[model samples]
Target chain A: MRKTKNSVSYNKWGYIFLIPFMTAFIIFQFIPLLNTIYNSFFENYLVGLNQVGPTFIGLDNYKSLISNGDLLIYTRNTLILWVMCFVPQIILSLTLAAWFSDASLKLKGTRFFKTVIYLPNLIMASAFSMLFFTLFSERGPINSILIQLGILSKPFVFFSSTIATRTLIAFMNCMMWFGNTTILLMAGMMGIDGSLFEAAQVDGATSTQVFFKVTLPLLRPILLYVMITSLIGGLQLFDVPQILTNGTGDPMRNTMTLIMFLNNHLYSKNYGMAGALSVMLFIITCILSLIIFKASGHDKRK
Target chain B: MENKKTKGMSVHARRTFSYIILVLVTILCLFWFYVLFINATRSNGELQSGFTFIPSTHLLENWKNLRAGTLPILSGLKNSLIISCSCVLFSVYFSTMTAYAIHAYDFKLKKFIYPFILAIMMIPTQVTALGFVKLVDAVSIFRDSPVPLIATTIAAPVTFFYMKQYMESTLPLSLIEAARIDGSNEFRTFNSIVLPLMKPAIAVQAIFTFVNNWNNYFVPALVLKSDDKQTLPILIARLRSADFLKFDMGQVYVMIAFSIFPVVIIYLFLSKYIVSGVALGAVKE
Candidate 1:
């Protein structure tokens, strides 16, 4: 009966509105993606002062990249920094989310605290990195304060040590993101069936028991989603580490992430290797996503 | 009776203790912004040795230094505003229109088209950076232009998803039907009728996109090479890397203070959307 009105002309309007977005998406995203795959196989070498040309070697680019150990170092650094940031971030956010959302605590001024906590994330990472850079610099207030407190005998360089640099990046990342994680986790908690918590409490479960048994289990899907997003974002870490260290990832490149490594290769005019690196990133992302998809309970959306 | 009263008193004490602790933590979280503000007000020499909770009086001097510096802060701010505002405008407007189309009308390739866009979200930005740069060079018409960077805003999957979620609930077919009955064309109905209704969603997304693009150092750092073309974050990063003799910490702090001003002001007015916005993104997932 409804098929008469839902005819071809009626549907023509959708395509007209959709054409602009589709044009942009295809040009910017889809074509480039295909270009990335096509370009990944060719090797470009400089033949003269300025002339360079692509020679298709068919997997030679990926072969050379894989043979090198720099990829491992980059992956290691990315994972380590991400783990350092994410472990603390998720824990603190969960604690904060649980405490604030719990009725018994009756946390005061939730809105104000939430706003303040999220404030750091809004400020540019360039500012945060610069602020921390100065704060930790020798003769800066941090060093002065440390000496005054007798924590150090004299001035010390925080960037000198790899651990220190990595820790600093990790800390800054956590500081900026935990508030967002808290809000997301709180939203997840809000989605939990209220009667389940009530049933647990009615069965003589303590607050801790209820939280551990009831709330956490229900939050698994949200946690998985958050973790996957963080994994992607964190692996591509560039700005803070780049700006804070003059894009050098200084002190022996301890803080250089996968994106930084990729950017460096691109700048040096090694387009083939850069494309290969991007493809490598894509492969790793797909593998990890599959692992997550399997590990996460197969709760297909209703 | 005394035992019961003492238990009640202890519970009251615990609540008070919790409040004090939470408040303290909140202040600790905000301490850096305060420190940044304070340092922005102090001279380079004063910032060297001493830590002061109270602000000193070098803000005007610092501003003067920023203006006098090699890197043009004001121009950077202007370029950033134009780039970000334009990106946000294009991103949200097109995304909403696309989502509206998906919601309102039936087309042959509709199902395949939307999920394909959603699927792109899984691919990291780095995956496309290499090819995207090559494409820009292949098509570049001008040097130090923000056009290439702005062009990428056209394909914003995240904004599309957010707008899709919004249009699902807020928009109804009957409204479109009524508008059609009144002899409104599709584009007219969208521009006149639908856009007004999407103001709240637009405002929330605009804030998110503005902050993201304004603070974005990735693409802008790549494309905007010339001093005048550089955005605030890039300029600040340069100032930050200045040699000791050349480095005036005062200018860095002041420039940072300037960079943060727009976002902080916007955040203050729209803090409410943030919590709900996160929830919106999460629940749909």
Candidate 2:
């Protein structure tokens, strides 16, 4: 009887503690998600409270989105930015983590290096936007230095060119985040048993051989984890482009990311169109994540 | 003797190469700080030069002007602190409670819930942003108010993920079971025994959440309409694009300094936990 009562009370307490999170999730996350899917089929307007209803429009929103030229361009730009940024990001992070882990280097001031590298990640996007703007603007330091070094005859308009703008965004993303990825990878490296390294060393393996044969293989799981998370994050890229490009997606809307396009639809009060885009983005993100999980061998365990 | 000598030479050369790489990385790290710091201090004229490493005396004046801007730098600082602190508090309390429940108890829904959380981790924030905005506007909470809670609360997902991961690994269920056997009720057991063990995890989550919230721009830009409620990031962005290149450059530096100071200070003090906490979260189970 006592055991029964105790278990009953424990269950009640558990439910009570869980109520807040569940409530927030249902109201905020789950319900909104359902509404978004539903709204994607309607023509929505920002009507007053008396007429706060959506007009049914079926698949028109999705059809329009598919045929939109700007949408196609945004999608292409986003992919380019992600690839340019993410490839170098993963490589640099792995390289740095490997270098830092080398026992022979015994590099002094590892903490200082780590802290400084991670500092940019802590700064708000606005400050970073401002800082980058000051650096890359036509009269900004980058152009000035290039011209002064006789590398360029004149100041090049960075934001005015699609390639330059996209490259700059990719560069900023890589610069700010490689530190975080490195830290994550390093942690993964540390978890590898010390015995493995010692055994490789005893077998007359060079450090390079030990890293390739032992470390890289061991770090694969964590590397996959990092890649998936970065992929999700890269898809959500918005702040830099929005702020740096002055929110118009200027220089011919060349840097208009998916999120920015979604934002534009929202601002125009085109709820149906925005919701359709949101669903499309969601489906694409989910499918890509699923593919990555499968490719990374996470699916086999389940 | 010849083989040994050659082996020694190769090792030495490798060591030298590694040292060179380390130096190069260290310089790279310093270069970012130098760029931001130098630009922040330069006059508009000198800023056009791009690579000036010399310090200028305009920092103080820039700071004063920054404070006097339309948004008032201090107000941005205040909003940032309030949002970050409140979000941290909410995340820490609820995350601890949820983690405790998940870890300490075996219940009917446990299996379904655990994997659900992991699956949701893959859903990018962009996919949810539009839906969240509509939901928030639909709710009456921010009906007439300028600030929307949705923008601030979207941070809950990452916080929950970190806390759940930490709790599963660091916490031992036996401890909670022991507390129950001692006649402590569930909340009491959690408040006393479990909460103390969670401090390290809490500290880690707190710093990450704080930094993320403090630097947040995109969500708030969408949700917030009033200038007074605008956080530092929005303020900086607004100031940067303002037609007046005439606005005090000194103030802009001051604003940058203000935006960076709190996180830097916290990071300096708790640097050790930051690395360990993230490592624990990102590495596979």
Question: Highest DockQ, which number?
Answer: 1
lDDT of 2: 0.75
Clashing residue pairs in candidate 2 are A141-B50, B62-B250, B62-B251, B66-B251
lDDT of 1 by residue, A113-230 (tens): 8898888888898878888888887777788888988999988899888998899999999988988888889989988877887888678676678878888888988898889888
DockQ of model 2 vs. true complex? 0.55
Model 2, residue A195: displacement in angstroms?
3.9
Which parts of model 1 have CA positions greater than 4 angstroms off? A1-3, A45-51, A298-302, B1-21
Q: List DockQ, one per candidate, in order.
A: 0.70, 0.55
Candidate 2 per-residue lDDT, tens place, A19-129, comes to 767776676677778888888999876654444348898998899889877778988878888899999988878877887777765656777777766766776766777
Candidate maximizing lDDT: 1
Per-residue CA lDDT of candidate 2, range B178-251, in tens? Answer: 88788888888888888888888888888887788788876676676665676788787787778736655545
In angstroms, the error of model 1 at A251 is 2.1
Please state the error at residue B223 of candidate 2 in Å: 1.6
